[model samples]
Target: MTAGQVSNNGPKPLQRNLSRRVSFNEATLARSQEPPKPPAEPEFIDTEAQVVSRPPYSACCNSCCAWTSLVLAVLLLLSILVGGVYFAFLQSNLPQVRLHRLDVYYLEVNNTDTDTFLTSDLEVRLNFTNDNSKIKLSYSRMTASLTAEGVDLGTVTVPAITQEPSSSADVRARTWMRKTSAEEAVAEDLRDNSLKHLMVIDVVLKGHIDFLVNGNKMNGFPIKVSCRSIDQSEIDNGHAPKCGVQMTPL
Candidate 1:
């Protein structure tokens, strides 16, 4: 074919459309074949900074130290005050208090009611001599324990006893020791009524106490309270003293 005949058979519209499609395809191909670009570098901050370290505060520590100092000062003051008081007490109350002699004069016990042990009464008489040269015992405290038939009954507190300087003083006290059933105490051991048969009494005269220098406690001479008898000659000779009263059935 001739050149003019081939050009006449070619499609003009289709060729224009094919050329646009090839242009888009070539742009896409070139974009897919290109290498990726690196990311932009991060921005650098160029700011001047000031370093600051907070200083320690001692408000709570100072408060605690002040409180501890106050407590220690208060404790030291209290100790000094107590020591001064103890020293003053020692200086004022302590004195040479001597015990002379405590002698029992009389003892009485009556047990008329065997069933009721509380209706009984007792009277004890005592004498004390003051042998101290510096101090005089004006008042005394005496305690006595009573027992019946080898059984402890009760205790009795005597009143104050007074003795002059190098002189003897008499003391007497009478009271009931309340319900003291000596028979009930020993009922488990002995079946028979040992308490009803006869009256048995044991009296103990503890050491006499004297209030020296007003209220200070001091020792006094020892004495005994008993219902046992003694000879009249011995009593007159100041040896064995006789007791006037004895025990009665309860």
Candidate 2:
């Protein structure tokens, strides 16, 4: 080939390569300037689908706890209401008791060098009244104690008694003080009072009582009856003193 023809062929191949490089650079530049394609629209991810679901047992447990709390609250309210009603019923329907009579059989006092000997016999009568129209009262065996001037004279057993609704009952107890000793001063006072027929004595009765309401027997409770300052003159004058009755607290 001639020298001019070879140079021309070489320059045409170089021009073709240059043109291809320019086309590739323009395509890259165009892609870089095209508003970045809005970051490919974030791949259309759903946030709710990605979140972890709660366990079924957890919801069930919460519901159960709520129901339990509600039930307990209801039970507490019912208990309070029932307690209030029971207390009211108790306050309105209490039994009535009193002393009916007192009797002195004999009293004797003897003096010695060191102490004084005393012997006495006495009887006590108590009246129990049940004012409740629908309830009955049953008393257990009781003990009666006799005291003269803060000195225990004797103790005796009293028989149990039952009273129907709106009815009254009486209990009698007899006590004998045998060969009891006392101080000289106390014996002198007792002897002087006995001679003058003006002796005073106190009686205390302790027992348990049960109530029957609507054919149901209730639990028993302790009871105390006190008859204080029973004078012989008052008994002679046909006056029956009223006694004080106390029961265990509910």
Candidate 3:
């Protein structure tokens, strides 16, 4: 080989090396030109948790409601029992009162031009019966009003009385009225009835009564006895008519 000329084999090796270096540089430049990749994000996992909670006063409220219901039920039961006992006692232990006889002694009516005057004398008898086995009854003063043919004659007062169980009592009342003003028509009717001996009188008695259970005084109740159309002839003929009795709450 000449000194000035390069050998072909040596040059060929150099060329090969330069080509490899050039290919590696091209690959690095291509990687640089591409866009940069973002950082990897952390993986996320979804999880569900179950929790149990209760109100602060739930147990206390439940207990209070239970006690309240129990108390109300007990009170209701007691009231029912007491009411039933009271009703039963009242039904079985009430006293009975009746009007036995009514006697009219003198009845006179005088009439003027436009006015009328009446004079009368009457007697009333009442019979009171207590059928209770263990109760006693006491009565207040009784007032009796007499009416003849729709004319108010007079009113009489009877004394108070007391009756034991299974016992009876009789009361008598007398009334004398003189020169009482009356309606003309009513006075005429009374005069005619009195002359024919067919006069009828209505007697209404009002009073109050109290019951004693084992010597304990109970509440007082009002009593009313009504004797309607009491015939004077029937009383004179030894016949007694029964009257209606009513007992009411005070």
On TM-score, the leading prediction is 3
lDDT of 2 by residue, 84-136 (tens): 89766664555666665667677778877777888888787777778988988
Per-model TM-score on C-alpha atoms: 0.32, 0.63, 0.64
User: Which candidate leads in lDDT?
Assistant: 3
Predicted candidate 3 versus true structure: per-residue lDDT over 103-169, tens digit per residue: 6678788888877888888788878888887988888968888887788878888899999999999
lDDT of candidate model 3 versus the reference:
0.80
In model 2, pairs of residues that clash are none
Per-residue CA lDDT of model 1 for 168-187, tens digit only, reads 66555444554544444353
**Which sections of candidate 1 miss by over 4 Å?**
1-118, 138-141, 177-180, 184-201, 205-250
- The 10 consecutive residues of candidate 1 with the worst lDDT sum are 94-103
